[model samples]
Target: MSQPSQALQIRTSDGIVFDVCLEVAQQMGLTHSWLQSERGDLKCSDGPDDDANVMPLNRVRSDIFKLVLDWCQAVQTVDTPLEHKEMLQHQRSLFQRILTESNATDSTIFELIIAADYLNIDGLLQAGTQHVADVINGCDSVEAIRERFHIMYEGEIDE
Candidate 1:
């Protein structure tokens, strides 16, 4: 049996806490990766399983984060030629891994945007950005965007 890492913890502002394995915490969207992009061991702010933004951490079930990390890493490295069928296959494999490994409607494809950007995966970043663009472009007006993403535009039009 593998000894679990001591680094994983879930902490919340409400004083809830839970100790979790690194993998479980990561699957919970409580990965250090999700907390912030600080080049350190992935962590929750408070401690293992403290449930800051996440209540009853078991509710958010998705290992898409792991796949996102793998995809970002694969895209950043030049081990495979981008245009090759093999490369597409690799990407597809990563996608499928996310599908199979993750449960819930969350795909983590959106999360890839941040990971790709943070890792400097230009092609992947462009892909993610473009996908977001396509989604936004489908909307005919600002109201549509606001409704879809729950954003309040705070812009001043200077004349």
Candidate 2:
């Protein structure tokens, strides 16, 4: 008989751990070619094992990691109701509300982009980068960009 794939234990920098299916993780691009070599036996070449395959994501914050995982789960499922324009609008509103409630700032979005890039999650990288662009689009000045991105310039300005 064939054995089923095992769940992977992903530990974030803040000590939060998530048990995710290998297939789902791979679908999110969380697993790469280098991971197999770096993690060695944790890749489970033979079959599923009882021990959790620990993958430490020391660079990503726990909350952001959870958010990405949630996004992955959400994308994996099909929602028929969301096809309607009204429903889609409502969902977008809800998403915005959640971000507002969570105090998700531009810095958070940038962090998500960095984490996504490091993890090779193309979907997240695209979404995050697009979000940043959308925020800065049509803005008039460098100050506006800096303010929106919560970045401070320490270096000397040219001209």
Candidate 3:
């Protein structure tokens, strides 16, 4: 009989630890690559007691990490391959749902974009950026866009 794969312990910047399944961890390109490069056995942690063996994601905040984990879980795939168009549409829909379900603010979406970039999650990055672009496109003017994203119109300050 085959042995069950152990969960990977991920410690975020805010000191929160999550016991993530190996499959979900694989969806995170950076984490998978890190694991492959290390080639060392990672101690599976059941709780947040020990930090020695936990993979540290210092750039990702706890709330964003939780959202990213939720996205990863939602998009976990089997061996089936999807075409580019279908995949893009599916990713867009999934991202929209994730944002709506989490009641994500514009600031939160922007944060997710940054986190996706850092994590090397291409799909999430693409979808997030696209969503931002779509929102911008929907706006009637620059001020509307700026207001929607809470961008202050900071004029040039005196040197």
> What do the candidate models score in CA lDDT, each in turn?
0.50, 0.67, 0.87
Tens-digit per-residue lDDT, 16-112, candidate 1: 4444544434432335455454335443456443444443323222242344445544445556456666665565555555445554232365655
Off by over 4 Å in 2: 1-5, 32-52, 79-101, 154-159
Q: Which pairs in model 2 have colliding backbones? A: none
- Please report how far candidate 2 places residue 51 from its true position, in Å: 7.5
Query: What is the TM-score of each predicted model, taking all chains together?
Result: 0.38, 0.67, 0.87
Task: Give per-residue CA lDDT, model 2, range 12-91, as digits (tens).
Answer: 89977778766667755556543575564464435334334667788899888766776566555655545556644543
- Candidate 3 achieves a global lDDT of 0.87
Model 3 clash tally?
0
Who is ahead in lDDT, 1 or 3? Answer: 3
Candidate 3 residues 1-159, lDDT tens each? 999877888889998888888889888998898788764667644555666667889999999998999889888852578899989998999999999999999889999999999999999999999999999999999989877877776673344
Q: How far in Å is the alpha carbon of 158 misplaced in model 3?
A: 12
Where is model 1 more than 4 Å wrong at Cα? Answer: 1-65, 70-110, 154-159
